[model samples]
Each structure stands twice: as C-alpha cells, then as structure tokens.
Target: MSILASSFHEGPLLDKYNNLLISHERYRAMFDNIPLAYMSMNENAAIIDFNNAFSELTGYSCEEVYMKPFSFFLYDKKDIEYHVNVTFPRFKRNGFARNQPWKLKHKSGREIYVIVHGNVRYDTDGRFIQTHCLIVDVTEQRLAREECQRAESKAQLILDVISERVTFHDREHHVLWANKNARSNAAPEC
Candidate 1:
C-alpha cells in the first residue's frame, strides 16, 4: 500500500531501470579501459583523470598528472592559446571535437605529435564541468609524409635533369642520367 512497495510491484519498469544501470556501468568500464590515451579535464584545463594508455604514452604516472594543469606541459606559448582559446572553447560549446593535432612536450622534454578527440560534459543544469579526450600519437605519420615529399622533390630533380637530353645509353643499355654535357657528347645521334 506504501509508495515504495508500489514501485517494487512495477516489475517491468524496475527491470528497465536495472538494465539501464548495467548498461551505463558497462559503457563506463569500456571508456576507462580503452587502448588509446583517454583523459578528462576540468574547466580550468586541469587534468582530472586519464587511462593507462595516457601514462604509457607520456611516461607520467596517473598520480603525477591528476589535478595538474593540462597546459603545464605545453612548451610552446602558441600551443597554449590554440588549445585553450580556440580548441577548448569550441569543444566545450559543441560537445565534441575531433582530430585536432597537437605538438605536445612530455615530462622528459621530448615533443610528440598527437591527434586529439575531445568531448565536454555538462552537469544537470547544463553547465560544463569536464572535458574528456582521446589521443593518438601521429609523429610517425607526419614524419613519413615529410619524408615522402622530400623523396618526391629529389625524383623531380632527377627527371628535370634527364629532360635535358644530354646523356646517353650506357654499354649495358641503361640510360645514363647525367649532366647535359655528358649526354650530348655520348648520344650525338639524337
């Protein structure tokens, strides 16, 4: 006859409520144990929490980063503004930001390139309380792109020199890609 007893009698609703709680717990566990670097920060940009992958990538223990200002590791002043003013505000307003590249300096003073995905969490009143992020180191990808550009430039130079038509075929039937003078002298028939 009591209200509490009546609620328990609502078996279908109780089952749904229990299922929702279980689903939420499973989601939280997955978020916390994800393989990539995951983190959350307060509105002041202080690191509130991070996962195991974060510690592994930055070489900092969880205890060391907790409550620390996220920008403390930013060696470049430009990066501080870029993250705080531009990236953070937009992310906080939009609820999500993705693949923003950062040149992050570690505790050991090594710089690493990382692409970050972030989301802002709001309290019941719809006020922003925390920002969560997932990070992936992209230094190798950036380096590989730069190296490919350099090699392409070198190959272009070789092609430009070969266009001069001054070189000739070698005795082994391979084209001698040399200076214009050598090609002109060797292949006078052309």
Candidate 2:
C-alpha cells in the first residue's frame, strides 16, 4: 500500500514501478563495490562462489578456487585439520557460526586473518543445501596486536635484566608490574 491514496496513486502503477526500478538500479551499482567479502559453499564444503572482495582478499580467481574444499585455503595445517574435523561439522549441526577466526593464505603466500560469519541453508524437507558466509578481513588488526605483544616482551626482558629498580603502575599509583630489582627492593628485610 502506498502513502498517497485519496484518488488512489493519482495515476497508473507505472510511475510507482519506475521509482522502484530506479532505486534498484542505484543499489545494484553499489553491490559490486561493497568491501565485505562474501562467499557460498555447497553442502560438501566446496567453494562454489564468492564476491569481488573475496577474490581481492585471497588473490585468487574464481576459476582457481572453484569446487575446492574451503579448508584448502587455510594457512596452517592445524587450522585446516580443525576446520575439516570440527568447525565444519559444528556449523552444519548448528546452521550458523559467527565471528569464527580463520587464517587464509593468499595466492601470493601472504597470510590473511579473518572472522567468518556463516549460515547454512536447508531444503524444504530439511536437507542441507549450502552455506552463505561473510569474511571480514582482520589481518592488519591481528598483526598490530602481535607486534605490540612482541614489543612488550622485549621491553620486559630488558627491564628484567637491568640493575635499576623499575616499576609500572596505573594512574592510581598501584603497582601493576615491577622488574626483578624493583621487586627485591620492595621486599621486607628479614
């Protein structure tokens, strides 16, 4: 039902159809440019199809990955094994999995970290048909976190070896961490 009624649309339905058609065309123009990668797999877990973002993220052409097991793109051996043996089966049973971590290797051998959100489709009779999934690329975020960890570890190691008393604290002045010398100095005398 449309908002303007009095005379009932004021004209034929052609104007309304034209408005809808124009709106759809504008949306279709943006569809291919969306940044979130999308993919779908058959019930067998084969890579059936993916969007342009997926192709850009993995550096693989549709022809190259077509019909391959989804796990085949994983970067680590353990991840591949776990996906095939655990995650896939769990998703099939649950019909949905969200924000599941995965590491995919690009065609150029770069590792890409991602969070997968997926849902399975079923036939009217309840047989599994396929899965629709979104792949959120998180490689830069993961790399930054790992880098920060390494930096902290290196700083801690240096602090541990120094003779000077060093302590880290929050704004409240409570000791959060104290290096070896700082710890010994704070200890009570026997």
Taking all chains together, each candidate's TM-score versus the true structure is 0.67, 0.80
- Cα lDDT tens digits, model 1, 36-107, are 888899988889888887877777887888888777756689999787888777888899988888888877
C-alpha-based local distance difference test score of model 2: 0.89
Model 1 per-residue lDDT at 190: 50
Displacement of the residue 105 alpha carbon in candidate 2, Å: 0.7
**For model 1, what is the error of residue 74's alpha carbon versus the real structure, in angstroms, after optimal superposition?**
2.9
Overall lDDT per candidate, in order of appearance: 0.81, 0.89
Tens-digit lDDT string for candidate 2 (2-118)? 465644556666577778989988875665468999888887789887778888899988788788898878999999899989999999889999999999999999999999999
Candidate 1 is scored at a TM of 0.67
RMSD of each: 7.4, 6.9
Model 2 lDDT at residue 96 = 99
TM-score: model 2 vs. ground truth: 0.80
List of clashing residue pairs for candidate 1: 166-183, 166-184, 167-183
Clashes of each: 3, 0
